[model samples]
Target: MHTTKRLTGAPGIYLLAANALVSTSAYALNTGTDLNLSMKPIAGGMAGAAYTNPQEVSAALFGNPATLTRFKSLHFELGAGLLEPNVDNTQTNDGYSHTSTSAARNYVVPDVAVSGEVLPGFVLAGGIGVDSGIGADYRTSPVNAGAGLGLGGAGAGGAATLPLVLELLSFSGNLGGAWEVTPDLSLGAALTVGFGLGQLGTTGSTTGLQGLSGNFGGTTSSVHNISLRGALGATYKVAPEWTLSTSIKSPLQYDYHSILSTTVNGYEQWQSVKVAQPLEVTWGVATDIVPNLLLEVDVAWKNWSSAALYQDIFQDQFLTMLGGQYTLDAWQFRAGYSYASSLLLNSPNGSLGGLDGVGTLPLNTAVPGVLARNDLTKVVQTTLAPVVWQNTLTVGLGYAFTQHFRLDGFGAYAFSENTSRSTLALGNYQVTASEWAIGAGANFSF
Candidate 1:
């Protein structure tokens, strides 16, 4: 007589975990939180918020719209950024480790805005920009696949030959206005509309000893969505040499629908998912300590703990399955520098980032044995998807060729960050991330 033991539970758990990992890993790129790239080259390089300056041009729309009241005439600006990022993942199992690097790619982010006094002490402005964005392309490797399937034990080697690929993109649009209540105080508000898209592909054997392997092999999936949110800000000139400003952004959420299809394997599936853009609050101060030079500083916070999309999906799984928290508060700092033809109105500024991991993952069934027996979580955390928080430094310059024409440029470098997660079941998962960005804009004033 012949008999066989079918490990039904193991493959199901692996597939489910793989699905969740795919979604979460898509957002773990250079930006830290989400796609919060600074649109103005001047302010971006200096890592500063141009909140207190009335002569800041259209870039002011990103900080305190109320600063728009500082503009005395019609202003228009346009610019774009070249962002390059490098991501590397290392997975270890049973004391064996392997590293894989993402393919090189350049992302172009655009910015445009206009502001003018529609009424005395009132400014009307509108613009379109990238609120958040990130993506990575990776080639399939036997080592990575082995790491992903190693949780099923040494016998799972046959399944590790599968090839995988991933890509993601997101952006937003804004419209707003500002009003000066008194010579020293101003208020501003804006609405943001968001959009995102993603794709995942894989190739390999569609079937194996049990049913666990047939679903995803030779499959491709795509997801996209739209969302909305709002922002409010205020600025006050406390003294001729000092200014204070603050801004708050509401949470943005999206319901992405994914459609999966396999041609060579003949399979298809559909899924619905939710993503959150955390709430943010910022405070800033600017001062002129000497002549023709200005300095500015800003502190900002992101409420990641309240990001329902991440908490609901990855948090519970991270805690119950991996014994950790998926959500944590994020903070950012920026300092600015400007040299002008005049006291301060003719100068340029810059800004930077820290602690921003801008993506989401899914939830799989909690199988303690699978997690405890091998470094399955490490593979999921490292090779499949990992979050990295980075620090940045930047510099900017601006020149006014004529009263009506001005140009600004900036360059920034983000320090590399290495992150690792360890579990008794598998071993350790580590990832290193870094990036570089450059931007320039032209402004016309009438």
Candidate 2:
């Protein structure tokens, strides 16, 4: 039996701080252009594409609501997972190489849902979960300080030295119903309300600059508002052993606002900004090749072209992001193996850029043109933190201890990928990232 412990006082603060260390980035599961993380261990173990099989109650709320029709008894489920991602960044300028790694090590995600037949042919379900999100926390480094503040080689000391933190959370509530039109056909729809919060913070010390000195800090300028969206899905039993399904999710848009604070000549100042989300669609099929043996596949497309994440980070913002379509999952002995493709866009050199007017300052008369140019380059490179594509593989297992109780667990590993950006001043900027996840959940039915 597993035991649970409650955290209090300093321990709770440490836990919260540990969670906060994870920064927000596109490399996260279902983050950036490809925003789809499996909410259940079975599906997550199957490469985040398990829409055709109605195996868990929570699947109905997150995947295909129509799958709820497959359940004959009332069902309840609750679970949580941890994701560990390691990101490394390296930049070489004038033959000097600087390397840094993300301080974030673990992310905790949880989910809960309940579903049942409300009538002869209809099923109703509701749930709450963390769908997809990203975060990053980098330790203090000379390179980060130099890049963040455009203070390249200014004082013997680098830019204000401190840790950088960024995080984005997407929490959602879902309500939906599924109807079995006939013995072999089902249709489902759901209304999803999402609440997203984005936070960014930076703190550091400054040198003998007369105007700008002391500590620097910032936070979200405004609280995020709840956003509404919808999803539609359909499943067809083509044969006694074959099932096909498809789902489309509307875009979720949130107006993000943030404030950057700093003291200039004994006076404080602040600035603000906004961002938007994207749309997505998924198609899948599952088949029983042999008795008690199943195979599943899924293809998903994300409309990142319309999202602000890519546009703000890359110059080639017109490219629509396409996710792995060849994801394959095979199940036997209540165990499953999965493979998923990458969801990143490969743009040409110089295709990526940074936000405008971020970290800009009046020219320092004391610095020479050469020094000023170098500093500006570092500033732009820092502002436009780079993101790349990655592929993943997963394994999962499900076990039944009794007629009414079941447990499921899974683990996934994302391959490492490196991407580079070339600019007139910064030369080449590169970032590499790799990730993995583990999750478990329990389901009850009677």
Candidate 3:
């Protein structure tokens, strides 16, 4: 009821028809292949691991609240990014290979924020952006995947087809401020309202909903939800050339109304579900590696093993990021690298919870020979939403033309990675993913 009340107008309508998918494979695990693309709200040369040292206005606003005090005067930054993610899916069974490439590319990521001194000892900040997104499309595949989902080749012959189509995006808007606590230490916090929207469809196929025995696989569902979360951070200057900072972000949960369901005797039934993002803790440090060079490194941990939907097949994640900035008379150069451990640290082996309105049955103890009908569902899910990317490389540039204006640009590439899983239910499933993102922006400081 509360979610419906807030999402009733144009925003809801656009979310329903919005096809400009951002990036990733699943709701909880789609943190993107690069920092600027999904993990952070930054643009161009500012696209590095920055928390201890604020790279730009938007970075401090959304990254580390305590870092906001780094801005002595009014500073404004407006930037956007064009991202292209390439994903491929392949499933082989009984001498047939069904492969399709993701048609969802060219996503627009925005970064708009400002920070300024509202008082003599305190500073204020605000920003909004698309945090993370991921999706896949198999509708255009000529393979006519009809193996396990019913029709074409279900039980009549060779395995089944899984032309699943899915898209999910997480967005946020925030407002907060920081204080100059002493001369060397700063403390601040930020509160944000998070929004999650997504659609899962099998491209005209009826999926197994547990207890629905015949002609299954032709079902689709969409969910839109909102929740609250906040972050607390502190930054301290260790010396004239080094700074240290850390931030702790609370977990955000999105309650989906009727996101899953079953059917009975020609009628469809539905139930609610909740998928939550994990709590995150990060530590960063910046120091002058040389006279004109500044280096920053950030390390973080994500508690995915304790989250809702993520806990099923995901483990706690550990991530690391590194960046460098070089200053010349009127020009600056930047380079960054970021890596995140696989979210699928513990892969699911035909394990899933209960389908709403249906009884829960463990695959290891199900009526002896039925072979657990849910296995097909597990295969469908794994093939549809797999998280596999791990390494990202980036390079950036910055130029200051005057004391009040500056320009920045950057380019990044995510190396391709592949994985193959074998299960009796779906034979063999494979996924490969990589990405490219680039953008430019300008900043004004007064």
Candidate 4:
């Protein structure tokens, strides 16, 4: 028996290890009381509510200005934590193993904010803090030549491989104020700004293949922009032991100019893309059920129907065949059950999806020339899939060792399962992929 020998050039593989990093880097939602700590107030998963206590009230400045009136002295919150991510995947079809390690223990994030008593009934507060701007980091080497997979050769002549990697980082900060009207009502607002960075690159060649063999190409880019945002908060002592508090943070409209640069065959190319992030709204209520014990829940919505964060391109096909663009949209609902132990525990998660009628290229021509398109209906219609919807549950505990020092621990479970099936062109073959992730973090305040 004789086996045929295939000759091929190296293929480029695009492995993204940091697809979504926002939820993994931010605070876990719980009750209006917990919000006063280093993380965002209002428990569960939104950033637009105020705090329950005076110390935590300063932390609320990031969401509402009127919260400042609750503070009397100049106070500050300084802290940081480590993020550990665990990702896993199981593939079918001509599946391949393209897994990645973790970037845990990378850096200690910090929070800094100060509030002062300006006059009898007025107060001012402003500070800089770090919040998870995206989700976790991941790397999976797709097995399709169309994916530019650089591992082993599976071509006409041999196999082709394209080695690609992606890394990401993000952060944000805000400054604002609050005023007291009657002794029971307060009104306030603030301005928020943020920045993000990402790196993507590829290199390698197909070996012993037919008509395809070459060096690699690499590219990396970053984005820095400013957007304006504001909020309003109010509290009413409905009863002697019961207080009703509510707040709203205006959604932000951002115009970001991303700086992109690439190098192919030792030549460099540069370009810029402008994109938008939708406005988000959050509302919730907190009550002291008993002494030192509290309960709260909040809901949030993100208008992701704005724009595509990245563009898609397929060589060898007519540009006219491309379909309309798509964006992301979601809603987060959170409820908290807590115990004011030497530690605090809060769990929050929600469901979100993309809009309807969007289209995606499910199958490309391995034979070349035939184009197949599907309604992103799978991704748009299903709560999960073709498009990606992520749900997260968080558990946090806080312990105060002494009067001036305290510590908080957070463990989070975030799952993102995409349900659409599609293929791209590489050496006339189809390519497909799916993913899932988990993460944890901690903080100390003085």
Candidate 5:
């Protein structure tokens, strides 16, 4: 993502394969690791709805810090988002087909939050953002550690290979307080400080890969870190126009370092991985029904088999979001929809059940990575972290211009997701993905 001559043995350990075994995994829009769902861009124009609809001050200090006591004074917001994903990975063996796209697409996510009235009804919050990153970009694809790895790198007298990179970038900072206990209940808490970066496997000379498929004889990989987490919330207002919410988050472990430096059967070995992020519970419902129409709904679970080194390919999942907003006076309009469900505990048709089959190739037996019952780690997790898009659609808008100032924007789309995997040790592997995004932000109050 290794060293090679048919890699040396057991499928030469898929030389530089499974790029960093999820070195920091995630390319989601709400499926795997959220890459900035909210932090305001006007809740990406409703699809993220900032929990109970709190748009400034760091999206309520991270979407639900008890709705930041409904903020009464001093506020500040700044945001920018521009994401792109149009991944296409095709690996055909018998007929030999190769295609690659995903130069990790373009990305930029930023946000700032500031709250005030630190004592009256109690509302203190802080913020920082740049939530997640790391999207695959098969470096021109043209390097085949052979025994049929068939990756590509269509070149033009240059960039011949030695780049394969799986990426991820994470950053966080919260700190919170919120309170209100009565006017209709409210409570909040926060304290997160995540920071993870990545660059899994391969470089100018091909390093290591196949985290569980074996042979990460890497020479040394990278996955830097700093994690610590927390989040708790509640909000009521039960009626008068409804509003009900809840939150809980506390899981984001990462212990990776020098993650690969392999050569294995030929010696050069080195490995490291820890990864975890689960235990997130959320529930929400908001309604305004008609004055200017506002609606929201959220549901999340994500327990992923208890979290640890990426919960063996994930299982306990559930996520759904639907949002709507419409105002008029100062102009506002938004829409949203999101869904997540598949992490396939059992091949949802991608086959790789690996009971004795599909394990051919020089794959020289290792299959240890994300252990979802090892079928060569599901053909190395559908060929390197295929988070398979579930569905997404969003729209956005906002403009205040005064009364304190405001401006928001949003746009999103994720539909096409193709996954076809068959392996008797590499026969058919097709991964197609699609995505789009646009964002904007600005706010100030006093």
Candidate 6:
């Protein structure tokens, strides 16, 4: 068990901002382009976790393939977005010393897709999109005593300045079909593939202090990786306006290869890290409330059980997260909650937990003695924080400008907290984030 007081005492404002970005990205799991299937109107009532009802043309690729049988022609969709992150935080130790930092940044992303029926009972569809939609930049000044030589002290020993940043992007594709097994029941199958491109940047000061300013300077690095994924689904019509559905989104496997380049004593050196990706599954249902109005609800499960302690250079100390979604005609709404296990709090040397994963021990030891004492190297696990917990709510609306063209928009708000133990390093920390999405599409029949 973890005490709230111990988890709440460590004051770091930037952490609040970081949690927001993470929550927003997590909410994107049910409504954003990567998982939303561009069918917000049919996804408004229930959380976007359902695999049974594929009301919109775009969603058929991931939900129920049998939904494709309802289409008579060709359809296409496109979307783009922007996100902002802001943070304010401080850290203090047993001594009278402390440090605070705040930062904000913006991110922009885009998506596109198309689908069509090639035969009486056969349909073909494909799309391009992104995922893991979050990142951050943080810095702090006014070095403290715990950061250098005490219970929370930095092993490096000195007054210092710090800044860090990370980004992840995924490009994915889909191909599948909806077969009318019976007049009212349809079965579907699909294959999904996603490729990831990313970069990591860091810059800071370890000098201008008492004993350790001579070890480092500004540094930066970048890398790339790819992942493969797939899924299958089925839907049964119980009545003229009611449908039941279920789907299994195959797990993603990843191979990451990267290099870490930084300046030490003004000289450049390189290191490498690697890790494997986690797997996820979802199931749900949909019903027509009235003409042109549809409702959907879903429940999903993610498998972090396949997660391990150390496969290669990376360590998998964290476990799974859970979420849900709902949709209605012309409007879509979504909400989700999840618990994330911690990798930072478990590794002896802060090493990456899987193949191609990176380590943080060297980076953790980069600070001066005075500021090193209070440096938090590990976050002990407990029920309260159990690593990390995130919650989110999303809203979306769509309008048909014409019979062939339509427009859709979405907004989401999210928050997260990580309280692992009952100490200053084990206390509670929070973050909030918001996102806006807009899309346009056209449908034509032959």
Model 2 lDDT tens row, 1-446 = 11212322221222211111111111111234333545475666666656777567777678777777877578888888898777776655445456666676687888788888889899888888877666656535422333223342333332233345556677889998899999999999988898987655453432322222223233223245578889999999999888888888787766554333322233333433344456667777788756555667666665655555444333322212111222223322233333434334443211112222112132111132223222332232232233344466677777777778878887777677776544332334467877778899988898
Writing each residue's lDDT as its tens digit, candidate 5 over 349-399 gives 121211112111222244344122243344344445667788888989998
Judged by lDDT relative to the true structure, which candidate is superior, 4 or 6? 6
Compared with the true structure, model 6 gives a TM-score of: 0.65
Q: What is the lDDT of residue 10 in candidate 4?
A: 28
The CA lDDT of each predicted structure is 0.53, 0.54, 0.61, 0.34, 0.61, 0.40
Against the true structure, what is each candidate's TM-score?
Answer: 0.75, 0.75, 0.82, 0.58, 0.33, 0.65
lDDT of 4 by residue, 273-336 (tens): 4333334344444555555544444343433333223111100110000001011122112222
Lowest-scoring 10 consecutive residues by lDDT in candidate 6? 23-32
Task: Assess the local accuracy of residue 173 in candidate 6 as a C-alpha lDDT between 0 and 100.
Answer: 70
- Cα error of candidate 5 at position 410, Å: 5.0
Best by TM-score: 3
Model 3 lDDT tens row, 1-446: 21121111121211111110100111112223223233332323433588788668777877778888988698988787777878877756556666667676788877777888999879998888766677766655512222333422243222333335666677778787899989889998998788888665444442222222322243346779998889899999889788999998888777767654333333444545566778888898999858998888888888977776556556788778788888998888888887879866434533333333211211222222323333333344344555676787878888888989988878887788887655443345577888878877778899
Give the per-residue lDDT of model 1 (tens digit) for 79-133.
Answer: 8888887778775666567776766458887888888898998888877777766
| Candidate with more favorable, higher TM-score: 3 or 6 | 3
RMSD of each: 11.8, 10.3, 7.9, 13.9, 16.8, 10.2
Worst 10 residues of 1 by lDDT: 316-325
Cα lDDT for residue 224, candidate 5: 80
What is candidate 4's CA lDDT for residue 409?
38
Question: Candidate 1: global Cα-lDDT?
Answer: 0.53
- For model 3, the run of ten residues with the poorest summed lDDT: 16-25
Residue-pair clashes, model 2: 11
